[model samples]
Target chain A: MENHERSIRLPDNGNKVKAMQQKLLGVAVIAIIFVAWFIAARIISKPLVLPDFVETMQQFFKGWVDSRTMSNLGITLKRVLTGSAYAVLVGTVIGLLMGYSTKVMMAVSPIVNSIRQIPIMAWVPLSIIWFGLGEGPTVFLIFMSAVFPLIINTVSGVTGIDPNYINAARSMGAGTVAIYRDVIIPGTLPSFLTGLRLAVGSGWMSVICAEFIATSKGFGFLMIEAQERMQTSKLYALMIMSAIVGFVIDQLIRLLEKRLTSWRFKNGKAVG
Target chain B: MARLSVDGVTKVFEEKGKEPHVVLENLRFDIEEGQFISLLGPSGCGKTTLLTMMGGFQAPTSGKILLDGVPVEGPSSERGYVFQNYALFPWMTVEKNVAYGMKFSSMSAKEKQEKLKRLIEIAHLQGHEKKYPIQLSGGMQQRAAVARALAGQPKVLLLDEPLGAVDFQMRELMQNELEHMVREAKITVVMVTHDVSESVFLSDRVIVLSSNKGRVVADVPIDLPRPRDRSSEEFDKYVFKLTNLVRRAFQERTDTTF
Candidate 1:
C-alpha cells in the first residue's frame, strides 16, 4: 500500500520540483543581467551620456516622490484610459457588424487596411491639423492608433467561431439577437481580450508621442524637457519608469488572458 | 397521429458554375408521435440533408416537409436538433446551456429552474451542472447537448449522428441512455446514423437509404426486444441482415452509374 501511494505521488512531486527550478533559473538570469548593467554603467565615460546606475536609481526615487511628476503620470494615464476605452467600444461594434455580414466586412476592409498601413506618427500631422495642439489631438491620435488592431482582432475572433456552435444555438430556438449575445460575444472573448492588449500597448505609444509633440503636461513632455536640459540621469529614470509600467500592464493583460483561456488549457494535454 | 411528414421530398444543390447535384429524390416518410425512427445510410447518402430538412434548417428543392400539417420555412422551437459534433456552447456551463432555449419563453425564473433541474437529472448530469462543455468528456458533452435540445420541450427531437464523436464504450452507454430518454419523454425522434448496430439498438424502425440520388430503399421494423444485447444471436442476425442491405444499396448505386 505504501509503495502504491509513493508511485501515485511521485509524478506530482516531480512536476512541482521542476516548476520551482524553472522559476529560480528565470530570477537568477534577470539578477545577473541587472548586475552586469550596473557594473557596465560604472565603467562608462561621461555621466551625461550614460549615467551611473546609482544616480539613475536616486533620480527615479526622487521622481516617484515629486508631486509634479506624479501629477504628470496621472495625466498620461487618464488620456490613455479614456482613448483606449473609446477605441475598444467603437472598434468592437464595427468588428461585430463586419464579422456577421460579408458585404459589410468587404466594404470596410479596404478602409481599415489603409488606415492600419499608416503609422501613428503619420497621424500626428493630420491630427494636429484637424484638432490643433491640445488634449483633443493627443486623445484622437491615441484612439486612431488603438482602433485598427482592436477591430481586426475582434472581427477575426468572431469570424473564426465554429459553425456548429451557431447551428446548435439556432436549433435551440435562439433568435439572431440571442445568438449574438449568448454565442458570438462569448465565443469571441479570448480574441477580443488579445485585441484589447494590443490596443493598450499601441495606445500607450501614441499617447506618449502625442504628449511629447503637442501637450504641455504628462510624462512624455517631462522626458522631452529632461532631454533638452541634458539631464541624462533623469531621462534614464523616466525611460526605466515607462518600461516598468509597460511591462506591468502587459503582464496584467497576460494574466487576464490566461484566466479567460483556462478552459482551453484545462485538459492538461496538447491537442493537434 | 404523425408529428412530422416528408412527402416526396427532394434536394438538389446548385453551385455557381456547375451542374446541380441531386442529394435526395422522392424521399417519403412519416414519423408518428412518440415513435423512434432512424435513418441509416453511408456517407453522402443524403441522410443528413433529409434530417436538416425535417429540422427546417434547409428546405427541399422540389417537395415539402410538414410539422403538424404546417410547412417548415426555417428553424422553429418545435423541432430540436442534436448535432453529431455535440455542439455544446463552450462558454456556458452545462446548466446555462440547458437554459439557453428557455430564455425567450415566458416561464418564470423559478419554473425554468425547476425544468432545468429535471433536465439535468434526465441527462444524468446531476453533479456537473456548473462545468463548461470543454471541461467535460465527449460523452458528457453529448449528454449536455441532448439536455439543451430537450430543454424547450420540443415536440420532435432530431438527431444527426449524435453519437458519432464518442468512443465505442461510451457510445454503448449513450445508446442505452438515449433509448431510455426517448421512452421516458415520449417525444417523436428521427436520428440519422451510419452505425447499423446503433440504429438497430435504439430505433423502433430503421429506414435504409440508397446513395447517389438518395432514396428510402427499405423500412425494416426492429422486432428485437428493448434493452438490446449486442452479442445475442438475434441481434447478430439483424446486424448481418442490415449490413448486407447497406452493401447492396452501395452496389446498386455503382451498377446504375456504370
Candidate 2:
C-alpha cells in the first residue's frame, strides 16, 4: 500500500466527477426506457393503442398540457398534499399513543389491523357513500391510503427506542414531559421519517383512485377521457405526467430524508 | 461521612408462573464522601442492577438506599449515573450532550455555561464539542458521557462499567483520565465492573459479589498511594488478591448450590 504512488490513480479529489457520473447513469437509464418506448410505438404503428413517443411528447408540450391539464394537475396535487398531511398528523399521534401504552395497543390494534387488511382500493365506493361524491370522498380515500402505514410505522418507531435513552434522560433530572420531548421523540425520528415516506407513496396512490371516481378534472380523469375519446397521444402524455409527478414527489421525500438525517450518514448510518 | 448508603438492600423478581429470582440479598455498604468504590463481579452478578438501584432508576424490594441521610425516591441530578453504553444522545453534538444534564439543573445561564466548559475540559473534549456522539470513537463517547454526568455538579457519580465499551488500548488511559476527573471533582464515585484490573486500578475499594444471591463476598481496600504503578509488586498483589477472592467466591457459590 505504501509503495503505491499518490498521484497515479487515486481519484481521491474527484468526488464531483463521481457525482456527475451517477447523474449520467440515471439519465442513461431513462434514455434507454425512452428508446424502448419509441421502438414499441414505431412497431405498433397504431396511434390509438400505443401512441408514438414523438406524438406523445408533442401532445404533452403543445396540445394536451394547456390551462385545463395544468389546472387538473394542480387540483390533484392539492388533494394529495391536504389529505396526506392530515393522515400523517393523525397517524403519528395515534401511533405514539398506542406505542407508549400497551392498553391502547390492545384496543386499537385489532380495529386498525382489520381495516388495513381491506384493500385501499376497496374503500372508494364506501367512502363515496359515507362522505358523498366530491372532494370529501377523494380526500377520505387519500387519507385512508396513507394512514395505516403511518400508524404502524410510528408505533414501531416509538416502541423501538433503546431503553437507555429513557433511563439516561430520567437520570439527567428530566421530568416526564422533558423525557418525551427531548428523548423519546428525537429517538423515534428515524422511524417516523420512514413511516412518512410510506405515507406519501400511498397517499399519492389514493389521490389517483379518488380522482378516477370523484372528480371531473385531474390526471386520472384526463386518462379516462382521453381513452374514451380515442386521443391516445393525450392519454400517453397524462400517463407520463403521472409517472413524472410520483417520481418527483418520491425524490423530494428522499431529498428531505437526506437533509434531515445527515447526522446518521455522517458516521456509518447509525440509526435509532 | 457516608455520602451514599446501601441499607440492607434486597431485590427479588417474581414471574407469574416461575419461582421468584432473588437478585441481591441484604446488600449493605456505605460509600464515603470522596471514595471511589467498585462492585466487581462476573457477568450477571447483579452489579449493574445494584448500580441502577443506587441511581434510583429502580427500587429495591425491601431495603433502601440513602444519600446524606435522605432516602432516594427517584433519579435526580444530585446522583450522576453513567450507563455502560454511555447512552449519549446520538442526535446531539458533544456540546449539546454535555449541556443536557445542565438544562434540568437549577444553575443560572452563566453558571451552567461555566460548568459545561469546565466539564468539557475535564473530560479532555475541548475541540470535539461540535461533533455528534455517533461520529465519535468509543473512548471519546465515554469522555463525553463523563462530561455530561459531571455537568449538573452531582455530589455522587455512579458508573456502570465505564470502560466496558472502550478499546483495549484506550481502556487504561480512559481509566486514568476518569480517576483524575473524579478526584478533581471531589465527588464520591460508585462503579460496577466485571474486570479485575479495572476495579483494582481505578477504585479505592473493590467490593466483590458472589453470583447465587448477589451477596458481597469480600470488600478489599487498596491503600496504594496516588499514581500507583501498575507494574509494581503492590499493585500486582492487590490484583492477585481480588482475582483469587472472586475465584473463591465463584467456587463457593457452585459448591453450596451443588
Candidate 3:
C-alpha cells in the first residue's frame, strides 16, 4: 500500500513540475526572441528598416490605450466573426446535401473544386466589383477563404461516419430526424469542428489581406497607415497585436471544441 | 408460428459490366421463441450478410423473412442487433445509451426506469452510467452494448460475432455473463460466429454453414446443461466434432477458389 501510494503520488508531482518547466521554457524562448530583435535592430542601425524591440513594445502598450486602435480592432473582429458565421451556416448545409446525395455531390463538387482552386487574393477583384468597396468586399473575401475548408471537412466527416452507428440508431427506432440529431450530427461533429478551425484561420488571414486592398479600417489599414508614414515601431506593434488576436481566436475555438464534444476527450483520448 | 423465419433467402451482388456474385444461396432457417441459435461458419461464408438480412438491414435477392408471420421490411425496434464492434454512440453516456431505445418503447417512465436499473445491474455497469463508451474497456463496452439492445425489450436479439472483438481472457467471463443475461431476459437470440467452441457453449442449435455459397452443412443441437464445463469430456467432444466440420468447410472453400 505504501509503494502504491508513492507510485501514484510521484506522477502527480512530476506532472506539476513538468508543466512548470514547460511554461518557463516558453517564457525563455520569448525572452530570447526579444533580445535577438533588440540586438538585430542595433546592428542594422536603421529605425525604418528594423525598429527597436523596446520601442515597438511601447507602441504595442500605447495602442491598447488608443481608442482608434481599439475601434479598428473591434471592426476587424466583427467582420471576421460575421464572415465566419455565414460560412459555417452555408457550408454546413451544402456539405450535408453533398454528403447525403450522390447527385448533389456530382453537381456541386466540380464547381466547388474549381472555385476552391483559385486563391483568396485572386477573388478580391471580383468581390470588389460585385459588392463594391468597404466592409462588403472584405467580408466576402473572408467568406470565400473560410467556406471551402468548412464544406470539405463537413463532407469528409459525413462520408466517413460509421454505418454501424446509423444501423444501430435505426434498429433503436430512430427516424430520419432522430438519426440526424443522434447519429449523423454527433458522428460528423469532430471533423466539422476541425474544418471550422481551419476555416476560421484562413478567414482571419484573408480578412487582413482584404482590408489591405479593399477597406479603409481594421488592423490591416492601421498597419498600412503606419508603414506609409514610416512608423516602423507602430507597424510592428500592429502586427504583434494581430498575431495575439489570431492566437486567442484559435484558442477560443479549441475551447469550444472541447465543450461541445466533451465525450471525445473524457479519457484523454478520442473515442470512436 | 416461428418468432423469426428466413424463407429461401438468396443474396446476389450485381455489379455493372460484371458477372453477378452469389453470396448466399437458398438459405432457410426458423428461430423459435426463447431459443438460442448460432449460425457458425468460417470467414467469407456470408454469415454476417445473412445476419444483416435477418435484421432487415438489407434485402435478399430472392424470398422473404417473416417475423411473427409479418414480412420483415426494414430495421425496426422489434429486432435488436448487436454488431461486432459494439457500436454504441460515442457521444452518449452508458446510461443514455442503454436508455436510448426506451424512448420509442411503449413502457411508461416508471417502467423504463425500473427496466433500465435492472439491465444496468445485470450488465454489471452500475457505477459507470455517466461514463462514455470510449472510457470503458472492451468487456465493459460489450456489456453496455448488450444492455442497450436488451433495453428495447425486442422480441428477438440478433448478434454478429458479438464476442469477436473482445480479448481472449475476457471472452469466457463475457460468455458467462451473456448466458446469465439471456437467462434472466428469457428472450430469443440468433448469433453469428466463427468460433466453434463459442457456438457449442452458447447455442441451443448450431447451424453450420459451408464456406462455399453459405449452405447449411449441419444443424447440431447442444444438449449440455447451463454453465457447462469447457474441459468436460462431453464439451470437448462437441467442440472437436464442430471444429472438424468447420475445417472441412474451410478446405472446400480453398479448393473451389484455386
Candidate 4:
C-alpha cells in the first residue's frame, strides 16, 4: 500500500522535473548553436569573413572599454532622448486637440493622414536639406519618424476613454481643467505608453539611417566606415552592438509598460 | 427646503432625417431633503434621462430643474451622480478615486483624509483603500463608487440603477447597504431602478414611469417599517400591487397603434 502511494506521488514530482529539464534544454540549444558557429569559423577558408566568436567577443569588449566608442554611443542615446521628448510633447498636444473637437478633427485629419503615408526614410533627404548635416538632421529624422505614430495612438487613446467617466466627472462639478487632468490624462496613459514604445523603435531606425548617411559618430557611422574599408569583422561587431542597444532600450520600455499596466493584472501577476 | 424640483421638464432627442423623439413630456417631481425616492420603470422610460437632466449633465428641451430652490443651469459640486457602470477611474487606487472630486475643493490634505476615511467606512471599503477598481469585485467597485460620490458631500445623490449589474444575492446585500448609507448620511437620494422589489425595499416613495413618451404614471408610497422584511405579507402585497401597475402600463402602451 505504501509503495502504491509512492507511485502515485511520483508523477507529480516527475512533472516538476520535466518542466525544469525543458528550461535547461532551451539553454543547451543556444550553447550548441554558438559552439557550432565557432567550429565552422575555424574550418572555413575565408576566416576574415567568418571571424571566430572569441575574436568578435574580444572586439566587443574593446569597443565598450574604449572611451571614444562609449562617447559615440552616449551621443546617439542623447539624440534619441531629445528627439523622443519633442515628439511626445508636440504629438500629445495635437492629439488632445483633435480628439476633443469634431471640427478640429475633421480639419486636421487629412493633413495627418498625408504626412503618415510618407516613409521615415523618404524624409531623410528633406531633413538634410532643411537642417543640414551633423546632429540636427539625424535628430530631425528621428523626431519626424516618431511623432506621427505617437499622435495617432494618443488620439485613439483619448477617443477610447469611456464617456461615462467624463459624465461622472462633469456631474461631480469638476471643471474642464480638472476633468482633463484627473480623468483624461490617467485614462490615456496606457495607450500613450504603447505609442511611446513604438516611437522609440521607429526613432532608433531613423536615427541610425541618418547617421549612416551623414554623421561622424555613433554605431551607424562606425558600421558604414567599416564597410567602406572592407572590414567585415568590424562591421559585424558594430551591428551586434546596435542590436544590443536596441534590445536594451526595448526591454526598458517594456518594463515601464508592465509597471503602468500592473493595476489591471492585480491577481494574475505580482507588480514589479 | 425641497432638495430638488423638476418643473414641467420635457426632453426631446433629435435624430437626423427622423422625427424628434420625445423622452419626457411635462414630467414634474419633487424630492424632499433626506427622503429616499426611487424612479421605477421599464427600460427606455427616460428615467435615466430625467436623472441626467436633474444632475445637469444635460438640459431639458423645454423645462427647468431646480435644486435647493435655485435653478440648475449647469452641473455643480452640490449634486453627486452614481452611474450604472460604476464609473470609477480604473487607473486610480480606491483612496485616490474617492479623493478625485475633493481635489477641486480647497480642503487641506488632512481634512480630505479625514473625510475619505469616513466615506470609506460608510461604504464598508476600509481595507480595500489601496486596491484599484479592476482588483475589486463588482459589488466592491460599486461600494467604492458610492464612497467616491459621498466624498464630495453633495446636497443630493443620484444613483442610476446602482445595483443593476450585480448578482441577485449581492444585489440584496447592496440594497441593505445603500439604505443604511442613505439613512446614516441623511442625504437626499433619487435612484432609478427597474427592479420592483429593490424599489419597495429601499424607497420611502416609488415613482412609476411609463415608457415611449415616458411619463410618470403612478406615485406609490411604501409605508413599511425600516429594515423591510421581503417575505412578509405586507411586502408581498406591495410587490403584487406594483406588478399590476407595471403590467397595466405595458399593456396600455402596447394597445396604442403606431
Candidate 5:
C-alpha cells in the first residue's frame, strides 16, 4: 500500500515544480564549478595551463561564428549522428542474428571478440591508413566504437525476452515473423535504449579522437589548433562547449530512456 | 460444447548419461464442454506440465490429445493459456494487451473492438485501459490476464496458478470473479493450482495428482451452486478430503517433508 502511494504519478503542478527545481539544480552546479575555476585560474595556475574563465567567455561569444566553432560543432554532431544511425541499424541485425541463431553466434563471436580486444585508439592509425585522413576515417572510427555496445546490448535485449510472452503470443495464433516483429522488438526496447545510451558516449569519444589525430575539422580539430597556437582562451572555450554538447546529448538520451521505460517506473518498483 | 480428451499421454525427460525420468506415465483425462477442471497436486507433481501439454506448448512423448475429435497440433487461438505471472506485454497498456489476440483473429476490426471492450468490462478493468500490468495490483493483473486470454473466445482457457500471487482476501474474490468470467464465456477451463480451497471453490471437477509418477489420484466433482460459501459445511468437506489426499500423496514421497 505504501508502495502504491509512492508510485503515484505526480500531479501537473507537482511535476512542473519538480522539473523546474531539477533544471535549477543542474545550472547551479555548473555555475559553482565555473566560479571555482575562475578563482583557481586567477590565483594559482599559469595562463597556458588554465586561462581566465571570464576572458574565455568574452572571446567565445565575440568570435563564436568567426572561428568556425559552431560549424565544426555541427560537423562533429552530424558525424556522430550518422555513424550512430548506421551502427544501430547494422548492429540490430547482427544482434538479432546472434540472439536467434546459435550457428550465427558461434561464427561471429570469435571475430567480435578479436575486434573488441583492439583498442579504439589503435583503430585511428589503421583507419587513416585504410581510408586516408578525411571523413572516411573519422566516420569509420565512430561507427566501430559505437557498434560494439549496440550489438552486445541488442543481443542481450532480444535473448532476454520473457519466454512467457513468446508463448502467449504464439498461443494467440501469431506467426513467427509477427511474434518477432510485434512482441520481441517492443519488449526489448528498454534494453536497446540502454545500449543507445552507452553507444552515444563511445561514439562521441571516437569522433573526437579521430578529429584530434587526423581530421582537419570538427570540435577536436578546433581544440588541437587552439593548443598549437597557444590560444589558451579558445582552448578553454572549446573545452566548455564540448562538455556542454556531451551533457545535453546525455540529458536528451536520459529523457528518452525515461519515456520509453515509463512502464517500468509506473509502479515504485518494476513489477514486470 | 468443447470436448477435450487426453489419452495415454506420457512425457519422459532424457538427460545426458543419466537415467531417464518419466514425468507423466500414460495419463488420461477428459474435460467436458464448459467444465472448470482444476489439476490440483503438491509441488512438482507435473500439474503445470500437464496443463502446458493441453495448451500444445509441450508435446507428449506418447499418445495424443484430441479437442472435439481433432488431434491437438501446435498452439492456436482455439486454446488460450494464462501463466501465473499474467504474461502481459509490459510495454502495452491493458487495452492493447487485451486487444492483442485480434491481430491473429479473423474477425473484422469492428468486431474485435466490440470484443475488446466487452472483455475489459468483464474483467472489471473499465478505467484501467490506459494502465500497464506493472501498475496494477496482483489481482488486477490476473484479471487483465484473464481478459487477454478470453479476447479470442477460445474453446478452453488454461490457467497455471491464476490466483497464486494475489493476497488472501483478494484471492477469494478473484477466484469467484474468474469462475463468473469463465461461465459467462462458456469456455472450457483446465486450471493448475495447489491451494486446496482454491481447487474446491473454483472447479466444477478437481483432479488431484500424486507425486512419484505424475498420475491422477482422485477426481472429485462439485455440484455446488454459484458463489459457494467457503465457510459452508459442504465446502469444508471437500477441502478436508482433498487436504488428506494431498497429505497422503506427500507422505508416499519420502523426499517430501509435507
Candidate 6:
C-alpha cells in the first residue's frame, strides 16, 4: 500500500518538472532564432538587403528615445483606439439585436457577412474617395477592418448565452429591458471581450496598411521613408518598434480581459 | 380553488417538413396550497416540460395553466423556478444573485435586507456570500439557486431535477436541505424528477407520468410523517413501487418504438 501511494505521488512531481522544462524550451527557441538570423545576415553581407543583427539592435534601442518615432507611435495608437472604440459600441448594440431577434439576424447577417468577406485593402480606394487623404482615410480603413470581427463575435456571444438564464430572469419578473440589462448583457461579456481583442489586433494591422498607402504621418509611413533613404538598419528598427508596441497593447488588453471577466478565471477552473 | 391547476394541458413540437409531434397530451392535475408534489417519470416523459409550463416558461398548445384561478400569461415573480443546473449568474456574487429576484419587488429596503439575511442563513451560505457561482461547489450552487428563487417570496416554487447535478452523497444532504427550506417558506412546490426514492422521501404526493405520451399513470400519496426515514421498510416499499412503475413506462415506450 505504501509503495502504491509513493508511485501515485511520483506523477504529481513529474507534472511540475515537465512544466518547468516547457518554459526553458520556449526560451531556447528564441535564442536559436536570433542566432540563425545573425548567421543569415553575415552570409548575405549586404546591409541594404538584410542589415547585421547588431546594427539593427543598436537602431532598435535608439528608436525608443527618438522623438520622431515616439510621435508616429502616438499617432498610430490614437487611430487604433478611436476606430476600435466605435466598433465595440456599435457592434455590441447590433449584435445584441441580432442575437435577440431572429428577424434582425436574418436581415443583417447576409449584408455583414458579404462585407466582411471583402479584403481591407480592397476598400482603400473607396475610403479615399469618401474621406479624402491623411487621417480620415486611414481611420476609416481601420474602422472598417475592426467592426466586422466585433460584430460577428458579439452576435455569437449573445446567441450563445444559456437560455436558462433568460428563463430564470423572466421567472423573476424581468421584462424585456430588464432582461437585456441583467441577463443578456452580462452573459455576453466574455464573448464581447474576446471580440474586442480580435478587433484590436486586426485594427492595428489595418492602421499600418492604411498609413502606408493613404497617410503621411504614422509608423507605417515612417518605415516607408526609411526604406526610400536606404537606412536599412533604421527601417528594421522601426519594424521591430511596431511589433513591440503591438505586443504591449495586446498584453494590456489581455490583462483588462482578465480584470473585467475575473469570474471566468476563479476557482482555478472556468465554469462558463 | 386549487393553488394551481393544469386544464387539459397538451404540448406539440412542430418542425419544418416534419409531423407535429405530441409530447404531452391532456396532462391534468391540481396542486393544493402549501403542498409538496413531485412529478415523477422516466426520461423523455415530459415531466420537465410540465414543470416549465407550470413556471410559465412555455405555454401549452391547446390548454391553459391557471394559478389561483388566473391563467399564467407569462413568467412572473409569483412563480419562482429552480433549474437542474442551478443557473446562478456567474458574474454576480452569491448575495447579489440571491437579491436579484427581489430587485423589483415591493418590499421596503429594511424588509428586503432582513429577508436576504434570513435566506442566507437558511441556505447555510454565510461565509460564501461574496463568492461567485463558479467558485462554489455543486451543492452550494444549488442552495444559492434555491435562495434566489425564495427571495421573491413566491407563492409556488417549481423545481426541475433540483438534485440531478449533485453526487449521490450530496444528493441526500441537499434533499434534506430542500425539504427543510420548503417547509420553512410555507410555499406550494411542484418538483420534477426521475428519482423514485427522492420523490417518495420528500413529496406529499407523487404524480407519475407514462413515457409514450406523457399521460398520467399513477397518483400515489406518501401519507408518511415529517423527517421520514429513508431506510425504513415503508419508504422502501414506496420506492420499489414507483421504480417499477417508471420502469414499465420506459419499457412501453421502447416496445412501441421498436
Per-residue C-alpha lDDT of model 4 across residues B1-258, encoded as one tens digit per residue: 678998999999999999988888998888888888999887878999998888888899998999988888777668888999999998888888888867677788999989988988988887778888887778778888887887788899899999999999789988988888888888889999999999999998999888756777899989999899999999999889888877766665677624
* Candidate 6 to truth, TM: 0.94
- Identify the CAPRI category of the predicted complex in candidate 5: medium
TM-score of each model, in listed order: 0.93, 0.93, 0.95, 0.90, 0.93, 0.94
Please give the C-alpha DockQ score of model 6: 0.55
- Give the per-residue lDDT digits (tens) of candidate 4, residues A1-272: 35754675688688779999998999899799879878988899464688777877777878888887788889889999989999999999988888877898999999999988998888888887888888888888888988988898889989999998998888676888988997888788888888998998889878888898868888678778878887666667777888889879999998898787777664534342
Which residue pairs show backbone clashes in model 3?
none
Residue A216's lDDT in candidate 2: 79
The 10-residue segment of model 5 chain A with minimum total lDDT is A263-272
Model 3: lDDT equals: 0.90
Highest TM-score: give the candidate number.
3
Screening candidate 5 with a backbone cut-off below 3 angstroms (N, C-alpha, C), the clashing residue pairs are none
lDDT of 2 by residue, B152-214 (tens): 888899999888877789888888888888888888899998889888888889999988678
Best by DockQ: 5
All DockQ scores: 0.45, 0.55, 0.58, 0.46, 0.60, 0.55
Q: Which residue pairs of candidate 2 clash?
A: none
CA RMSD, predictions in order: 3.6, 3.4, 2.8, 5.2, 3.2, 3.5
Across all candidates, the chain A TM-score values are 0.88, 0.87, 0.91, 0.84, 0.86, 0.90
Candidate 5 chain B, which ten residues in sequence have the lowest lDDT sum?
A: B249-258
DockQ of 2: 0.55
Off by over 4 Å in 2: A1-26, A63-65, A267-272
The alpha-carbon lDDT assigned to residue B23 of candidate 5 equals 80
* Runs off by more than 4 Å, candidate 3: A1-27, A266-272, B254-258
**After superposition, candidate 1 runs with Cα above 4 Å error:** A1-24, A258-272
lDDT of 1 by residue, A1-272 (tens): 35754675688789889999999999899889778868887887678888887888899999989999899988888888889899999999999999989999999999889878998888888888898887888889889998988999999999999987887788777889989998899889889989999998988888888888987899899999999999999999998888887777888988888777665654433221
CA lDDT of B208 in candidate 5? 88
